[model samples]
Target: MRPRFITLEGVDGAGKSTHLGFIRATLLTLGIDACFTREPGGTRLGERLRELLLAVETEVSLETETLLMFAARQQHLAEVIRPALVAGRWVVSDRFTDATFAYQGGGRGVANARIAVLEDWVQQGLQPDLTLLFDVPTEVAAQRMAATRELDRFEREEGDFHRRVRAAYLARAADNPRFYVLDSTRSIADIQSDIAQRLAQLAEQP
Candidate 1:
Protein backbone atom coordinates (compact mmCIF):
# COMPACT_ATOMS: atom_id res chain seq x y z
CA MET A 1 0.00 0.00 0.00
CA ARG A 2 1.23 3.45 -0.89
CA PRO A 3 1.48 5.90 1.93
CA ARG A 4 -0.75 8.94 1.85
CA PHE A 5 1.12 12.14 1.09
CA ILE A 6 -0.42 14.87 3.20
CA THR A 7 0.79 18.47 3.09
CA LEU A 8 -0.10 21.54 5.13
CA GLU A 9 0.27 25.04 3.72
CA GLY A 10 -0.36 28.52 5.04
CA VAL A 11 1.00 32.01 5.21
CA ASP A 12 3.39 32.80 8.04
CA GLY A 13 1.61 32.75 11.43
CA ALA A 14 -1.41 30.97 10.06
CA GLY A 15 -0.80 28.29 12.70
CA LYS A 16 0.32 25.67 10.21
CA SER A 17 3.00 24.25 12.48
CA THR A 18 0.60 24.00 15.39
CA HIS A 19 -1.90 22.15 13.25
CA LEU A 20 0.85 19.90 11.98
CA GLY A 21 1.57 18.76 15.52
CA PHE A 22 -2.09 18.22 16.21
CA ILE A 23 -2.54 16.18 13.04
CA ARG A 24 0.48 14.05 13.86
CA ALA A 25 -0.91 13.26 17.28
CA THR A 26 -4.28 12.43 15.80
CA LEU A 27 -2.72 10.04 13.30
CA LEU A 28 -0.76 8.31 16.03
CA THR A 29 -3.89 7.93 18.14
CA LEU A 30 -5.52 6.26 15.17
CA GLY A 31 -2.66 3.76 14.90
CA ILE A 32 -1.27 5.13 11.65
CA ASP A 33 2.47 4.93 11.05
CA ALA A 34 3.37 8.47 10.14
CA CYS A 35 6.40 10.68 9.61
CA PHE A 36 6.34 14.45 9.96
CA THR A 37 8.67 16.68 7.98
CA ARG A 38 9.03 20.03 6.25
CA GLU A 39 10.38 21.01 2.91
CA PRO A 40 13.79 22.72 2.44
CA GLY A 41 14.98 21.27 5.73
CA GLY A 42 13.99 17.63 5.97
CA THR A 43 17.56 16.45 5.32
CA ARG A 44 21.05 17.82 5.96
CA LEU A 45 21.47 19.35 2.55
CA GLY A 46 17.96 20.67 2.62
CA GLU A 47 18.59 22.20 6.04
CA ARG A 48 21.62 24.09 4.77
CA LEU A 49 19.58 25.26 1.83
CA ARG A 50 16.86 26.37 4.20
CA GLU A 51 19.27 28.49 6.20
CA LEU A 52 20.55 30.14 3.07
CA LEU A 53 17.07 30.72 1.83
CA LEU A 54 15.72 32.15 5.05
CA ALA A 55 18.73 34.03 6.37
CA VAL A 56 18.17 37.77 6.75
CA GLU A 57 21.56 38.67 5.30
CA THR A 58 21.51 36.43 2.28
CA GLU A 59 20.11 38.29 -0.70
CA VAL A 60 19.12 36.56 -3.91
CA SER A 61 16.97 37.36 -6.92
CA LEU A 62 13.44 36.01 -7.14
CA GLU A 63 14.42 33.58 -9.90
CA THR A 64 17.42 32.43 -7.94
CA GLU A 65 15.31 32.04 -4.83
CA THR A 66 12.71 29.97 -6.61
CA LEU A 67 15.34 27.70 -8.14
CA LEU A 68 17.12 27.24 -4.84
CA MET A 69 13.82 26.33 -3.18
CA PHE A 70 13.19 23.68 -5.81
CA ALA A 71 16.74 22.41 -5.50
CA ALA A 72 16.21 21.87 -1.81
CA ARG A 73 12.82 20.31 -2.41
CA GLN A 74 14.29 17.86 -4.91
CA GLN A 75 16.85 16.73 -2.38
CA HIS A 76 14.18 16.50 0.32
CA LEU A 77 11.93 14.35 -1.85
CA ALA A 78 14.74 12.06 -2.98
CA GLU A 79 16.20 11.59 0.48
CA VAL A 80 13.19 11.57 2.81
CA ILE A 81 9.71 12.03 1.43
CA ARG A 82 9.61 9.59 -1.48
CA PRO A 83 11.43 6.86 0.41
CA ALA A 84 9.14 7.11 3.44
CA LEU A 85 6.03 7.11 1.30
CA VAL A 86 7.33 4.10 -0.62
CA ALA A 87 7.88 2.39 2.71
CA GLY A 88 4.18 2.86 3.48
CA ARG A 89 4.54 5.48 6.17
CA TRP A 90 2.27 8.49 5.99
CA VAL A 91 4.38 11.53 5.03
CA VAL A 92 3.08 14.83 6.31
CA SER A 93 4.78 18.04 5.29
CA ASP A 94 4.64 21.65 6.48
CA ARG A 95 4.67 23.04 2.98
CA PHE A 96 5.28 22.18 -0.66
CA THR A 97 5.13 23.53 -4.25
CA ASP A 98 2.21 25.80 -3.61
CA ALA A 99 4.52 27.81 -1.39
CA THR A 100 6.73 28.67 -4.30
CA PHE A 101 3.75 29.76 -6.31
CA ALA A 102 2.60 31.94 -3.45
CA TYR A 103 5.90 33.45 -2.44
CA GLN A 104 7.68 33.78 -5.74
CA GLY A 105 5.02 33.93 -8.39
CA GLY A 106 2.37 35.79 -6.49
CA GLY A 107 4.27 37.88 -3.98
CA ARG A 108 7.31 38.64 -6.07
CA GLY A 109 5.35 38.93 -9.31
CA VAL A 110 7.30 36.22 -11.09
CA ALA A 111 5.76 34.75 -14.18
CA ASN A 112 3.53 31.78 -13.51
CA ALA A 113 4.84 30.07 -16.64
CA ARG A 114 8.37 30.17 -15.34
CA ILE A 115 7.34 28.76 -11.99
CA ALA A 116 5.27 26.02 -13.59
CA VAL A 117 8.21 24.96 -15.72
CA LEU A 118 10.49 24.68 -12.76
CA GLU A 119 7.85 22.89 -10.70
CA ASP A 120 7.31 20.32 -13.43
CA TRP A 121 11.01 19.65 -13.67
CA VAL A 122 11.70 19.39 -9.97
CA GLN A 123 8.58 17.51 -8.88
CA GLN A 124 8.59 15.21 -11.91
CA GLY A 125 5.43 13.17 -11.26
CA LEU A 126 5.16 13.42 -7.49
CA GLN A 127 2.30 15.31 -5.84
CA PRO A 128 0.62 15.30 -2.48
CA ASP A 129 -2.54 13.24 -2.09
CA LEU A 130 -3.99 15.93 0.18
CA THR A 131 -3.06 19.56 0.76
CA LEU A 132 -4.62 21.43 3.68
CA LEU A 133 -4.35 25.17 3.20
CA PHE A 134 -4.86 27.24 6.34
CA ASP A 135 -6.31 30.47 5.02
CA VAL A 136 -6.33 33.78 6.85
CA PRO A 137 -6.69 37.41 5.94
CA THR A 138 -3.44 39.21 5.22
CA GLU A 139 -3.86 41.72 8.02
CA VAL A 140 -4.73 39.00 10.50
CA ALA A 141 -1.76 36.89 9.48
CA ALA A 142 0.52 39.90 9.77
CA GLN A 143 -0.76 40.70 13.24
CA ARG A 144 -0.18 37.14 14.36
CA MET A 145 3.30 37.13 12.93
CA ALA A 146 4.15 40.42 14.58
CA ALA A 147 3.19 38.95 17.92
CA THR A 148 5.77 36.22 17.42
CA ARG A 149 9.55 36.56 17.33
CA GLU A 150 11.47 38.67 14.84
CA LEU A 151 10.48 38.11 11.23
CA ASP A 152 12.49 36.21 8.66
CA ARG A 153 13.25 37.59 5.21
CA PHE A 154 10.14 36.14 3.63
CA GLU A 155 7.99 37.13 6.55
CA ARG A 156 9.22 40.72 6.33
CA GLU A 157 7.82 41.29 2.89
CA GLU A 158 5.35 44.14 2.46
CA GLY A 159 1.69 43.70 3.34
CA ASP A 160 0.67 43.86 -0.31
CA PHE A 161 3.00 41.02 -1.09
CA HIS A 162 1.45 38.83 1.57
CA ARG A 163 -1.98 39.72 0.31
CA ARG A 164 -0.98 38.53 -3.12
CA VAL A 165 0.40 35.33 -1.69
CA ARG A 166 -2.82 34.62 0.17
CA ALA A 167 -4.85 35.35 -2.94
CA ALA A 168 -2.72 32.98 -4.96
CA TYR A 169 -3.17 30.21 -2.42
CA LEU A 170 -6.94 30.67 -2.53
CA ALA A 171 -6.88 30.60 -6.34
CA ARG A 172 -4.91 27.39 -6.36
CA ALA A 173 -7.20 25.76 -3.84
CA ALA A 174 -10.22 26.82 -5.82
CA ASP A 175 -8.92 24.94 -8.84
CA ASN A 176 -7.71 21.76 -7.15
CA PRO A 177 -9.98 19.22 -5.52
CA ARG A 178 -7.09 17.74 -3.56
CA PHE A 179 -6.60 21.07 -1.82
CA TYR A 180 -8.61 21.74 1.36
CA VAL A 181 -8.95 25.27 2.64
CA LEU A 182 -9.55 25.90 6.33
CA ASP A 183 -10.10 29.16 8.19
CA SER A 184 -7.17 29.70 10.47
CA THR A 185 -8.90 32.54 12.31
CA ARG A 186 -11.05 29.98 14.08
CA SER A 187 -10.00 28.52 17.42
CA ILE A 188 -7.20 25.97 17.31
CA ALA A 189 -9.36 23.20 18.70
CA ASP A 190 -12.02 23.88 16.12
CA ILE A 191 -9.45 23.77 13.36
CA GLN A 192 -8.04 20.53 14.72
CA SER A 193 -11.47 18.95 14.94
CA ASP A 194 -12.22 19.97 11.37
CA ILE A 195 -8.92 18.53 10.25
CA ALA A 196 -9.73 15.30 12.09
CA GLN A 197 -12.98 15.05 10.21
CA ARG A 198 -11.20 15.61 6.92
CA LEU A 199 -8.65 12.96 7.70
CA ALA A 200 -11.40 10.52 8.61
CA GLN A 201 -13.08 11.16 5.29
CA LEU A 202 -9.82 10.51 3.49
CA ALA A 203 -9.36 7.27 5.39
CA GLU A 204 -12.78 6.17 4.25
CA GLN A 205 -11.93 6.58 0.57
CA PRO A 206 -11.05 3.51 -1.48
Candidate 2:
Protein backbone atom coordinates (compact mmCIF):
# COMPACT_ATOMS: atom_id res chain seq x y z
CA MET A 1 0.00 0.00 0.00
CA ARG A 2 1.27 3.41 -0.90
CA PRO A 3 1.42 5.85 1.96
CA ARG A 4 -0.61 9.06 1.90
CA PHE A 5 1.10 12.37 1.24
CA ILE A 6 -0.84 15.12 2.96
CA THR A 7 0.00 18.80 3.16
CA LEU A 8 -1.65 21.66 5.05
CA GLU A 9 -1.23 25.17 3.69
CA GLY A 10 -2.41 28.69 4.51
CA VAL A 11 -1.24 32.23 5.13
CA ASP A 12 0.59 32.97 8.39
CA GLY A 13 -1.48 32.60 11.57
CA ALA A 14 -4.07 30.38 9.92
CA GLY A 15 -3.30 27.83 12.67
CA LYS A 16 -1.82 25.18 10.40
CA SER A 17 0.86 24.06 12.88
CA THR A 18 -1.71 23.82 15.64
CA HIS A 19 -3.80 21.43 13.57
CA LEU A 20 -0.81 19.29 12.66
CA GLY A 21 -0.58 17.95 16.19
CA PHE A 22 -4.25 17.09 16.22
CA ILE A 23 -4.01 15.38 12.87
CA ARG A 24 -1.00 13.38 13.98
CA ALA A 25 -2.83 12.21 17.10
CA THR A 26 -5.85 11.21 15.07
CA LEU A 27 -3.72 9.23 12.63
CA LEU A 28 -2.01 7.44 15.49
CA THR A 29 -5.37 6.44 16.92
CA LEU A 30 -6.18 4.88 13.56
CA GLY A 31 -2.94 2.85 13.77
CA ILE A 32 -1.38 4.65 10.84
CA ASP A 33 2.36 5.21 10.79
CA ALA A 34 2.57 8.93 10.21
CA CYS A 35 5.47 11.38 10.12
CA PHE A 36 5.20 15.12 10.52
CA THR A 37 7.53 17.55 8.78
CA ARG A 38 7.71 21.12 7.51
CA GLU A 39 9.24 22.64 4.46
CA PRO A 40 12.52 24.64 4.45
CA GLY A 41 13.60 22.93 7.65
CA GLY A 42 13.02 19.22 7.33
CA THR A 43 16.69 18.48 6.82
CA ARG A 44 19.97 20.10 7.88
CA LEU A 45 20.50 21.78 4.53
CA GLY A 46 16.88 22.78 4.42
CA GLU A 47 17.13 24.31 7.90
CA ARG A 48 20.02 26.50 6.80
CA LEU A 49 18.02 27.61 3.80
CA ARG A 50 15.07 28.31 6.06
CA GLU A 51 17.16 30.64 8.18
CA LEU A 52 18.35 32.55 5.13
CA LEU A 53 14.87 32.84 3.79
CA LEU A 54 13.28 34.01 7.00
CA ALA A 55 16.09 36.14 8.48
CA VAL A 56 15.12 39.79 8.95
CA GLU A 57 18.54 41.17 8.14
CA THR A 58 19.18 39.22 4.96
CA GLU A 59 18.17 40.80 1.66
CA VAL A 60 17.22 38.49 -1.19
CA SER A 61 15.70 39.02 -4.60
CA LEU A 62 12.43 37.37 -5.59
CA GLU A 63 14.10 34.96 -7.99
CA THR A 64 16.78 34.16 -5.46
CA GLU A 65 14.15 33.45 -2.84
CA THR A 66 12.22 31.16 -5.15
CA LEU A 67 15.30 29.20 -6.14
CA LEU A 68 16.42 28.86 -2.53
CA MET A 69 13.02 27.52 -1.56
CA PHE A 70 13.26 24.92 -4.29
CA ALA A 71 16.74 24.04 -3.19
CA ALA A 72 15.53 23.37 0.31
CA ARG A 73 12.54 21.44 -1.00
CA GLN A 74 14.75 19.22 -3.12
CA GLN A 75 16.91 18.30 -0.16
CA HIS A 76 13.86 17.75 2.02
CA LEU A 77 12.30 15.43 -0.52
CA ALA A 78 15.46 13.42 -1.05
CA GLU A 79 16.30 13.07 2.63
CA VAL A 80 13.01 12.87 4.44
CA ILE A 81 9.70 12.78 2.53
CA ARG A 82 10.19 10.39 -0.37
CA PRO A 83 11.77 7.64 1.68
CA ALA A 84 9.07 7.77 4.33
CA LEU A 85 6.30 7.65 1.77
CA VAL A 86 7.91 4.74 -0.03
CA ALA A 87 8.06 2.85 3.25
CA GLY A 88 4.29 3.20 3.72
CA ARG A 89 4.56 5.88 6.38
CA TRP A 90 2.05 8.69 6.13
CA VAL A 91 3.78 12.03 5.55
CA VAL A 92 2.15 15.23 6.75
CA SER A 93 3.64 18.58 5.95
CA ASP A 94 2.83 22.07 7.22
CA ARG A 95 3.44 23.67 3.84
CA PHE A 96 4.54 22.75 0.34
CA THR A 97 4.88 24.09 -3.19
CA ASP A 98 1.57 25.89 -2.97
CA ALA A 99 3.15 28.28 -0.46
CA THR A 100 5.82 29.29 -2.95
CA PHE A 101 3.24 29.97 -5.61
CA ALA A 102 1.21 32.03 -3.20
CA TYR A 103 4.02 34.06 -1.65
CA GLN A 104 6.56 34.45 -4.46
CA GLY A 105 4.42 34.36 -7.57
CA GLY A 106 1.22 35.95 -6.39
CA GLY A 107 2.42 38.27 -3.65
CA ARG A 108 5.71 39.29 -5.18
CA GLY A 109 4.30 39.52 -8.71
CA VAL A 110 6.77 37.00 -10.06
CA ALA A 111 5.85 35.51 -13.44
CA ASN A 112 3.86 32.32 -13.28
CA ALA A 113 6.00 30.86 -16.02
CA ARG A 114 9.11 31.28 -13.94
CA ILE A 115 7.47 29.76 -10.90
CA ALA A 116 6.15 26.80 -12.89
CA VAL A 117 9.56 26.13 -14.34
CA LEU A 118 11.18 25.98 -10.93
CA GLU A 119 8.40 23.85 -9.49
CA ASP A 120 8.72 21.35 -12.29
CA TRP A 121 12.46 21.25 -12.02
CA VAL A 122 12.39 20.67 -8.29
CA GLN A 123 9.30 18.54 -7.77
CA GLN A 124 9.59 16.48 -10.94
CA GLY A 125 5.80 16.03 -11.01
CA LEU A 126 5.50 15.09 -7.35
CA GLN A 127 2.35 16.37 -5.61
CA PRO A 128 0.56 15.91 -2.36
CA ASP A 129 -2.18 13.28 -2.45
CA LEU A 130 -4.30 15.62 -0.32
CA THR A 131 -3.89 19.34 0.33
CA LEU A 132 -5.88 21.03 3.08
CA LEU A 133 -5.97 24.77 2.56
CA PHE A 134 -6.99 26.79 5.59
CA ASP A 135 -8.79 29.78 4.17
CA VAL A 136 -9.32 33.07 6.03
CA PRO A 137 -9.64 36.74 5.29
CA THR A 138 -6.35 38.61 4.95
CA GLU A 139 -7.17 40.94 7.84
CA VAL A 140 -8.09 38.08 10.15
CA ALA A 141 -4.91 36.24 9.44
CA ALA A 142 -2.79 39.36 9.75
CA GLN A 143 -4.31 40.28 13.10
CA ARG A 144 -3.72 36.78 14.41
CA MET A 145 -0.11 36.84 13.24
CA ALA A 146 0.52 40.24 14.81
CA ALA A 147 -0.76 38.94 18.11
CA THR A 148 1.70 36.07 18.02
CA ARG A 149 5.37 36.08 16.98
CA GLU A 150 7.23 38.98 15.42
CA LEU A 151 6.75 39.30 11.65
CA ASP A 152 8.99 37.40 9.30
CA ARG A 153 10.08 38.84 5.97
CA PHE A 154 7.07 37.49 4.10
CA GLU A 155 4.66 38.27 6.92
CA ARG A 156 5.71 41.91 6.90
CA GLU A 157 4.35 42.46 3.38
CA GLU A 158 1.38 44.77 2.77
CA GLY A 159 -2.25 43.76 2.99
CA ASP A 160 -2.68 43.94 -0.78
CA PHE A 161 0.08 41.37 -1.29
CA HIS A 162 -1.58 38.95 1.12
CA ARG A 163 -4.91 39.47 -0.63
CA ARG A 164 -3.29 38.51 -3.90
CA VAL A 165 -1.84 35.39 -2.27
CA ARG A 166 -5.27 34.44 -0.95
CA ALA A 167 -6.82 34.92 -4.37
CA ALA A 168 -4.18 32.77 -5.96
CA TYR A 169 -4.78 29.99 -3.43
CA LEU A 170 -8.51 30.08 -4.19
CA ALA A 171 -7.80 29.84 -7.89
CA ARG A 172 -5.46 26.90 -7.33
CA ALA A 173 -8.02 25.14 -5.18
CA ALA A 174 -10.63 25.64 -7.87
CA ASP A 175 -8.46 23.92 -10.42
CA ASN A 176 -7.26 21.06 -8.23
CA PRO A 177 -9.62 18.32 -7.13
CA ARG A 178 -7.19 17.06 -4.50
CA PHE A 179 -7.40 20.32 -2.58
CA TYR A 180 -9.74 20.69 0.41
CA VAL A 181 -10.38 24.28 1.41
CA LEU A 182 -11.66 24.84 4.93
CA ASP A 183 -12.71 28.00 6.77
CA SER A 184 -9.91 28.44 9.28
CA THR A 185 -11.58 31.06 11.46
CA ARG A 186 -13.43 28.34 13.32
CA SER A 187 -12.33 27.06 16.73
CA ILE A 188 -9.40 24.65 16.91
CA ALA A 189 -11.57 21.77 18.07
CA ASP A 190 -14.00 22.38 15.24
CA ILE A 191 -11.19 22.52 12.73
CA GLN A 192 -9.74 19.27 14.09
CA SER A 193 -13.12 17.59 13.82
CA ASP A 194 -13.47 18.76 10.25
CA ILE A 195 -9.99 17.48 9.40
CA ALA A 196 -10.66 14.06 10.94
CA GLN A 197 -13.91 13.82 9.03
CA ARG A 198 -12.16 14.74 5.80
CA LEU A 199 -9.39 12.21 6.42
CA ALA A 200 -11.96 9.47 7.06
CA GLN A 201 -13.63 10.33 3.79
CA LEU A 202 -10.34 10.14 1.96
CA ALA A 203 -9.55 6.77 3.52
CA GLU A 204 -12.86 5.42 2.22
CA GLN A 205 -12.36 6.55 -1.35
CA PRO A 206 -11.58 4.02 -4.06
Candidate 3:
Protein backbone atom coordinates (compact mmCIF):
# COMPACT_ATOMS: atom_id res chain seq x y z
CA MET A 1 0.00 0.00 0.00
CA ARG A 2 1.07 3.60 -0.61
CA PRO A 3 1.99 5.40 2.58
CA ARG A 4 -1.02 7.13 4.08
CA PHE A 5 -1.05 10.66 5.46
CA ILE A 6 -3.08 11.35 8.61
CA THR A 7 -3.64 14.54 10.58
CA LEU A 8 -5.08 15.30 14.00
CA GLU A 9 -6.75 18.70 14.34
CA GLY A 10 -8.82 20.63 16.84
CA VAL A 11 -9.00 23.95 18.65
CA ASP A 12 -6.56 24.46 21.51
CA GLY A 13 -7.23 22.30 24.57
CA ALA A 14 -9.31 19.89 22.58
CA GLY A 15 -7.23 16.95 23.90
CA LYS A 16 -5.37 16.09 20.71
CA SER A 17 -2.11 15.97 22.68
CA THR A 18 -3.68 13.61 25.20
CA HIS A 19 -4.51 11.04 22.55
CA LEU A 20 -1.40 11.21 20.35
CA GLY A 21 0.50 8.52 22.21
CA PHE A 22 -2.34 6.07 21.89
CA ILE A 23 -2.52 6.60 18.14
CA ARG A 24 1.23 6.10 17.82
CA ALA A 25 1.13 2.89 19.83
CA THR A 26 -1.84 1.54 17.94
CA LEU A 27 -0.20 2.18 14.57
CA LEU A 28 2.97 0.53 15.78
CA THR A 29 0.98 -2.53 16.78
CA LEU A 30 -0.67 -2.55 13.38
CA GLY A 31 2.77 -2.72 11.74
CA ILE A 32 2.57 0.68 10.09
CA ASP A 33 5.92 2.48 9.81
CA ALA A 34 4.58 5.90 10.72
CA CYS A 35 6.46 9.17 10.92
CA PHE A 36 4.74 11.34 13.49
CA THR A 37 5.29 15.09 13.54
CA ARG A 38 3.55 18.38 14.22
CA GLU A 39 2.82 21.39 12.11
CA PRO A 40 4.83 24.66 12.24
CA GLY A 41 7.72 22.76 13.82
CA GLY A 42 8.52 19.59 11.92
CA THR A 43 11.60 21.01 10.19
CA ARG A 44 14.42 23.06 11.75
CA LEU A 45 13.29 26.31 10.14
CA GLY A 46 9.68 25.55 10.97
CA GLU A 47 10.46 25.11 14.69
CA ARG A 48 11.95 28.60 14.80
CA LEU A 49 8.85 29.93 13.11
CA ARG A 50 6.73 28.02 15.66
CA GLU A 51 8.45 29.82 18.53
CA LEU A 52 7.71 33.16 16.90
CA LEU A 53 4.13 32.23 16.17
CA LEU A 54 3.34 30.93 19.64
CA ALA A 55 5.24 33.50 21.72
CA VAL A 56 2.77 35.84 23.37
CA GLU A 57 5.23 38.74 23.35
CA THR A 58 5.77 38.56 19.60
CA GLU A 59 3.74 40.99 17.48
CA VAL A 60 2.49 40.23 13.99
CA SER A 61 -0.26 41.48 11.73
CA LEU A 62 -2.86 38.88 10.77
CA GLU A 63 -1.77 38.59 7.15
CA THR A 64 1.89 38.30 8.12
CA GLU A 65 0.98 35.59 10.60
CA THR A 66 -0.90 33.60 7.95
CA LEU A 67 1.94 33.93 5.46
CA LEU A 68 4.51 32.86 8.01
CA MET A 69 2.46 29.76 8.83
CA PHE A 70 2.43 28.68 5.21
CA ALA A 71 6.10 29.55 4.92
CA ALA A 72 6.87 27.15 7.78
CA ARG A 73 4.58 24.55 6.25
CA GLN A 74 6.34 24.81 2.91
CA GLN A 75 9.65 24.03 4.57
CA HIS A 76 8.09 21.26 6.66
CA LEU A 77 6.69 19.54 3.58
CA ALA A 78 9.88 19.81 1.54
CA GLU A 79 12.22 18.73 4.32
CA VAL A 80 10.17 16.33 6.45
CA ILE A 81 6.70 15.21 5.41
CA ARG A 82 7.15 14.56 1.70
CA PRO A 83 10.48 12.88 2.16
CA ALA A 84 9.18 10.54 4.89
CA LEU A 85 6.17 9.54 2.79
CA VAL A 86 8.29 8.93 -0.28
CA ALA A 87 10.48 6.63 1.81
CA GLY A 88 7.39 4.45 2.57
CA ARG A 89 6.58 5.83 5.98
CA TRP A 90 2.98 6.59 6.86
CA VAL A 91 2.91 10.28 7.82
CA VAL A 92 0.88 11.53 10.75
CA SER A 93 0.83 15.22 11.61
CA ASP A 94 -0.54 16.76 14.79
CA ARG A 95 -1.96 19.63 12.84
CA PHE A 96 -1.93 20.59 9.16
CA THR A 97 -3.62 22.98 6.71
CA ASP A 98 -7.01 22.69 8.38
CA ALA A 99 -5.54 24.49 11.37
CA THR A 100 -4.74 27.56 9.29
CA PHE A 101 -8.28 27.48 7.98
CA ALA A 102 -9.62 27.42 11.54
CA TYR A 103 -7.28 29.76 13.42
CA GLN A 104 -6.48 32.25 10.64
CA GLY A 105 -9.55 32.07 8.48
CA GLY A 106 -12.36 31.46 10.95
CA GLY A 107 -10.96 33.10 14.07
CA ARG A 108 -8.90 35.95 12.60
CA GLY A 109 -11.25 36.56 9.62
CA VAL A 110 -8.95 35.72 6.72
CA ALA A 111 -11.06 34.69 3.75
CA ASN A 112 -11.25 30.96 3.08
CA ALA A 113 -10.58 31.60 -0.61
CA ARG A 114 -7.36 33.37 0.33
CA ILE A 115 -6.21 30.43 2.44
CA ALA A 116 -7.23 28.06 -0.34
CA VAL A 117 -4.92 29.80 -2.80
CA LEU A 118 -1.92 29.29 -0.53
CA GLU A 119 -2.98 25.69 0.16
CA ASP A 120 -3.01 24.89 -3.54
CA TRP A 121 0.30 26.59 -4.20
CA VAL A 122 2.13 25.12 -1.21
CA GLN A 123 0.67 21.62 -1.01
CA GLN A 124 -0.02 21.15 -4.67
CA GLY A 125 -2.68 18.39 -4.40
CA LEU A 126 -1.43 16.74 -1.23
CA GLN A 127 -3.87 16.30 1.68
CA PRO A 128 -4.25 14.06 4.68
CA ASP A 129 -5.77 10.66 3.96
CA LEU A 130 -7.61 10.99 7.27
CA THR A 131 -8.08 13.96 9.60
CA LEU A 132 -9.28 13.16 13.12
CA LEU A 133 -10.90 16.27 14.52
CA PHE A 134 -11.33 16.17 18.29
CA ASP A 135 -14.06 18.72 18.99
CA VAL A 136 -15.33 20.22 22.25
CA PRO A 137 -17.20 23.25 23.51
CA THR A 138 -15.06 26.33 24.03
CA GLU A 139 -15.87 26.34 27.76
CA VAL A 140 -14.64 22.76 28.13
CA ALA A 141 -11.46 23.51 26.23
CA ALA A 142 -10.73 26.61 28.31
CA GLN A 143 -11.04 24.68 31.55
CA ARG A 144 -8.68 22.00 30.27
CA MET A 145 -6.07 24.58 29.32
CA ALA A 146 -6.29 26.31 32.70
CA ALA A 147 -5.65 23.07 34.57
CA THR A 148 -2.64 22.18 32.41
CA ARG A 149 0.26 24.04 30.76
CA GLU A 150 0.82 27.76 30.22
CA LEU A 151 -1.28 29.24 27.45
CA ASP A 152 0.26 30.18 24.12
CA ARG A 153 -0.77 33.35 22.25
CA PHE A 154 -3.45 31.51 20.35
CA GLU A 155 -4.62 29.71 23.47
CA ARG A 156 -4.89 33.05 25.28
CA GLU A 157 -7.66 34.16 22.95
CA GLU A 158 -11.19 34.60 24.35
CA GLY A 159 -14.04 32.11 24.22
CA ASP A 160 -15.83 33.48 21.17
CA PHE A 161 -12.68 33.18 19.10
CA HIS A 162 -12.41 29.48 19.91
CA ARG A 163 -16.07 28.99 19.04
CA ARG A 164 -15.38 30.32 15.59
CA VAL A 165 -12.40 28.04 15.29
CA ARG A 166 -14.50 25.02 16.27
CA ALA A 167 -17.15 25.99 13.80
CA ALA A 168 -14.64 26.20 11.00
CA TYR A 169 -13.35 22.75 11.84
CA LEU A 170 -16.84 21.23 11.74
CA ALA A 171 -17.46 23.01 8.46
CA ARG A 172 -14.43 21.38 6.97
CA ALA A 173 -15.38 17.98 8.35
CA ALA A 174 -18.87 18.29 6.91
CA ASP A 175 -17.52 18.84 3.42
CA ASN A 176 -14.75 16.26 3.45
CA PRO A 177 -15.14 12.51 3.76
CA ARG A 178 -11.56 12.35 5.06
CA PHE A 179 -12.47 14.00 8.35
CA TYR A 180 -13.68 12.08 11.46
CA VAL A 181 -15.02 14.42 14.13
CA LEU A 182 -14.74 13.04 17.65
CA ASP A 183 -16.79 14.50 20.49
CA SER A 184 -14.08 15.03 23.05
CA THR A 185 -16.42 15.85 25.92
CA ARG A 186 -16.75 12.12 26.49
CA SER A 187 -14.44 10.06 28.66
CA ILE A 188 -11.00 9.14 27.35
CA ALA A 189 -11.88 5.47 27.16
CA ASP A 190 -14.90 6.17 24.99
CA ILE A 191 -12.99 8.49 22.69
CA GLN A 192 -10.09 6.11 22.27
CA SER A 193 -12.43 3.25 21.50
CA ASP A 194 -13.81 5.26 18.61
CA ILE A 195 -10.36 6.30 17.50
CA ALA A 196 -9.04 2.77 17.59
CA GLN A 197 -11.94 1.61 15.50
CA ARG A 198 -11.31 4.28 12.93
CA LEU A 199 -7.58 3.67 12.84
CA ALA A 200 -8.21 -0.04 12.35
CA GLN A 201 -10.44 0.78 9.41
CA LEU A 202 -7.77 3.06 7.97
CA ALA A 203 -5.20 0.29 8.33
CA GLU A 204 -7.28 -1.84 6.00
CA GLN A 205 -7.27 0.75 3.23
CA PRO A 206 -4.93 0.52 0.25
- Return the lDDT, model 2, position 3: 83
Who wins the TM-score comparison? 3
Choose 1 or 2, whichever is better by TM-score: 1
Candidate 3 colliding pairs: none
Which candidate should be chosen as best, given lDDT against the real structure? Answer: 3
Ranking by lDDT: 3, 1, 2
In the range 1-206, model 2's lDDT, one tens digit per residue, is: 45889999888878787787788888877777698899878999999889889988879888899889989999999999999987889899889999988888888888888989988988888899999999999999999999988998888889999999999888899999999998999988788888999887766666
Error of 1 at 30 (Å): 2.2
In order of appearance, the predictions have TM-scores of 0.97, 0.96, 0.98
lDDT comparison, 1 vs 3, better candidate:
3
Task: State in Å the error of residue 76, model 3.
Answer: 0.5
- Clashes (backbone N, CA, C under 3 Å), per candidate, total 0, 0, 0
Tens-digit lDDT string for candidate 1 (32-125): 8788899768999989999999898999988899889999999999999989987889899889999999889889989999989988887788
Minimal lDDT window, size 10, model 2: 197-206
Residue 155, model 2, lDDT: 87
Q: Note the residue pairs that clash in candidate 2.
A: none
RMSD (Å) per prediction = 1.1, 1.1, 0.7
List lDDT for all candidates, in order. Answer: 0.88, 0.88, 0.95
**Residue 96 lDDT in model 2?**
93
Per-residue lDDT, model 3, residue 111, is 94
